[model samples]
Target: MHRVAVLLLAPVVGFDATIAPTLFGTAAGGDGEPLYEVTTCAVEPGPVASTNGFAIVPTAGPEALDTADTVVIPGTRYPPARTGRGVEDAVAAAFARIRPGARVVSICTGAFVLAAVGRLDGRTVTTHWKYADTLRELYPAVRVDENVLFVDDGDVLTSAGLAAGIDLCLHIIRCDHGVQVATAVARHCVVPPWREGGQAQFIDRQVPAGDHAATAATRAWALAHLTEELTVHTLAEHAHMSLRTFNRRFRAETGEAPGSWIRQRRIDRARELLESRDIPVDEVARLSGLGTGGNLRHHLRRGMGMSPSSYRKVYQGA
Candidate 1:
């Protein structure tokens, strides 16, 4: 079982702190055994106040981080209160206790702590959209993207906001275990199994008033027809709208371009096949509408940072 340490910074966002253990701890293996052991700790052993009225008393201290395989930091009210000030001295020392090569993760404004410790330097990351500009200005070396739900930088990961933390945790479980395990956890937790990290954070949407033509039917049709060639023109016809209008409406409703949405769907199909089926790469590619094994290789590596075989190996418990 993996050992996960939840490191609490004082004034931590209550929701963010709870997500790690709740999702990871609830995950189980084929034998109904817990996959992870979760421990909550602090810089110093004592009561730590949260953003809300409640306070928590941690059972462990910074030393807990040293033995953890993963360290998760939730959002805090610390950064915004002091603009340029970064991690506290005690916090820095605690962070340093994490052993080399252990995965590090942050939720919402918890990114400030990672950035302060120079862990996110020159790496792409995201925080809550409201704080994107501030993070960029304060840490010029860190590449900050405000739009995506989360940014996965291999061993280091950061999520956008409170709920996005759940998304990130599910994704990690998917990568570590497989789709079935992650899906079971999601079903137990009453959350969606997958949402692409690149999907945009909600922006003000201009929904057409009553009786306006919607793209819901077209999207459903496209999902069913993923193995077929799908283009903007073809989808526009199915929706009974001109190409331009379909493009505009699709982006408004889905927060992605029609082409990008199709690509994502194709990737999702490919991932399912890779996880559940034992077939040739070429066949998987053709079934997923990626045209050829080479194309699937390119896209999978671009989107998931791993080859089809590598993904299959990890998912199959090899």
Candidate 2:
């Protein structure tokens, strides 16, 4: 089993702190064996205060970091991390115990902890959009992109506030195990199976009035018919709107233009087929609306850096 250590700093965000243990703890293999061993640790074992007006009692101390295969730092209001002054000496020592090459993750303002320790220097990362500017001001070297739900920079990962941490955890599960396992975990958690990391973080926007004016129905229809040639013009007609109006409303609601959104959906469909079905590559492409083996190979390689066969072998163990 993979070992996960969640390090709780003082005044941790309660919701963020729970995400990893909940999602990872829920993951199980075919025989119902847990896939990850999750342990919550702190600099000093005892009651760690939370921003939510409560406290968490961790069973382990900083030594937990030394044996972890992955270390997660949830959002914290620790002054040194928040103010960019530096990390506490004890916190620094705790971070030092993380094994070299072990994955490091941050949830919401936890990016501040990573950044303060210089782990995020020159790395593209994100935090809650509300604090993006503050993070940027505090650590100019860490490239902060507040638009996306999360940024997965291989060994290091960061997510936007609250629920987005769930997305990142599910993503990590998918990467470690496979899509089916991740989907199962999401189902158990009563959350969506997948939300692309690049999906927009919630931003304040004026929602179009009424179901009649929104493009949600059309988007759902498109998802159901991904094998068809979905175009901006066709979607506009289906939504009973002019092409220009459809384009505007689609981008406003989904944060992606119609063409780009359709392509991504198609690619996602292709991936699902690749993992779950024993079909020819060309057949998977046609079913996913990509049309041909060559096209599927091109898109798979470009998006995932793997051929369809390679992806199947990795995920399906075929």
What is the lDDT of every predicted structure here?
A: 0.87, 0.91
TM-score of each: 0.88, 0.95
- Per-residue alpha-carbon lDDT of candidate 1 for residues 1-318, written as tens digits (9 for 90 to 100): 699999988898999989998999998987789999898999876888999889878778888899899999999877532275776788878888899999999999989888888898999999999998988888889999989989888899999999999999999998888877888899999998887788787767666764348888898899899999999999999999999889988887777899988988888788878988899999999999888999999998997789999988877641
State which candidate has the highest lDDT: 2
Off by over 4 Å in 2: none
Lowest lDDT 10-residue stretch of candidate 1: 79-88
Question: Which candidate has the highest TM-score of all?
Answer: 2
| Cα-based lDDT at residue 231, candidate 2 | 83
lDDT of 2: 0.91
